[model samples]
Target: MNGWNLAAAVLLGAGGTAALWGVTTGPPARRVIAQNMTTSAVCPALLLLSQGYGRPAYVDLALLLALLGPVGTLVFARLLSDDLSDGPPSARVLTWTAAGAGAAVVLAVCVAVGPGRALVKLLVTGALLIGGNIIASRALADGFQGVRGG
Candidate 1:
């Protein structure tokens, strides 16, 4: 594969591996964050793959995952609210790091594609990926405290 593909492979390998480990061997709260991370990791890799392979399908997949993955995490967080009542997990560091990586990858891909419908889609995907990620992380940390109080 080319450099893009290789970059994708390395990212998937490193991020996926770490996320997998965290998910499999942690408390429910930690596992939920790890699950969110799965999306952060894979979405960027998918973008890289899409660029490397010159296939729009991979971008579509990345977009779908970027949109859905956080929803899934929020659902899990809501379900596990009891476990998180103590306080929001201290995951800001991890969350921002993952978000940063996603932003970087998206910027790289956007540069490669230049301006077009594809660029628009990439920006949307990146926005959703980073925006959704922060939103989901906040929900996880807040654990519906405001909602429950109201």
Candidate 2:
């Protein structure tokens, strides 16, 4: 496989394994955080795979994941708010680290794509990914009480 594909493969293998392990074997709060991480982990790999395969269309998959991943996490956080209210997990470091990674991936892809409409799409995807991740993490940390009440 080419370097991009190889990199994508390695990332998907390692990150997916870790995310699955964390989600399956953790306490409620930890599980939620891990679930949220899956999006960040997989979206970048998908982006890499798209680049490696020379298929711009595959990028749409990553875009959709960026948009929907956090929504799913937020659903979990809301439904499990009662369970997490006891001492809501604050994975600030992990959250920011994931955001940084997503940002770096998007930036790298943008640089590779250069200035174009595709670049704009990548930027939008990156913004959604990072913003949604942060919002989901905050909801998890706060137990989503505000949302529940309103």
Candidate 3:
């Protein structure tokens, strides 16, 4: 009802719809990129919802998603490397754009939360989200050849 919830609803609805479409009906590489995008989109929306609902505890959901989303993406990248290796998608623009968005969202939340343990947690989550995103994108692009004993 409020702006935060409305924003979250819009993000979840629009972003999720796009991601689902991309993931469900695209080449393997495109699907991987879409899957990666879902994390960036949903995590921020969850943060907004937590604020909108005035539930600090709800932030935990966002935090966990920020932490685990990339792990899951990496798993997909690793497992599907062979499928992607043929033409490993190079989505540098998309990757950095998503990272920037994640950073912006985390900073916005941190500013709203003010300096404290919550701020530290938000910062950590932002770092993890961006760092993991970059790493996962690299893995997807390169087929993680280095990690694959190549």
Tens digit of per-residue lDDT, candidate 1, span 1-150: 899999999999999999999999967778888999999999999999999999976799999999899989987887778787875675999999999999999999999999999999999999999999999998887778756533
Clashing pairs in 1: none
lDDT order of candidates, top first = 1, 2, 3
RMSD of 3: 1.6
Give lDDT tens digits, candidate 3, residues 21-70: 99999789999999999998899899889878988788888889988998
CA shift of 67, model 2, Å: 0.6
Clashing pairs in 3: none
lDDT of each: 0.91, 0.89, 0.86
Indicate the worst ten consecutive residues by lDDT in candidate 2.
141-150
Instruction: Give the per-residue Cα lDDT of candidate 3 at 8.
Output: 88
Error of 2 at 126 (Å): 0.8
Where is model 2 more than 4 Å wrong at Cα? 147-150
- Comparing 1 with 2 on lDDT, the higher-scoring candidate is 1
- Residue pairs of candidate 2 with colliding backbone atoms: none
Question: lDDT: which is higher, 2 or 3?
Answer: 2
RMSD of each: 1.6, 1.3, 1.6
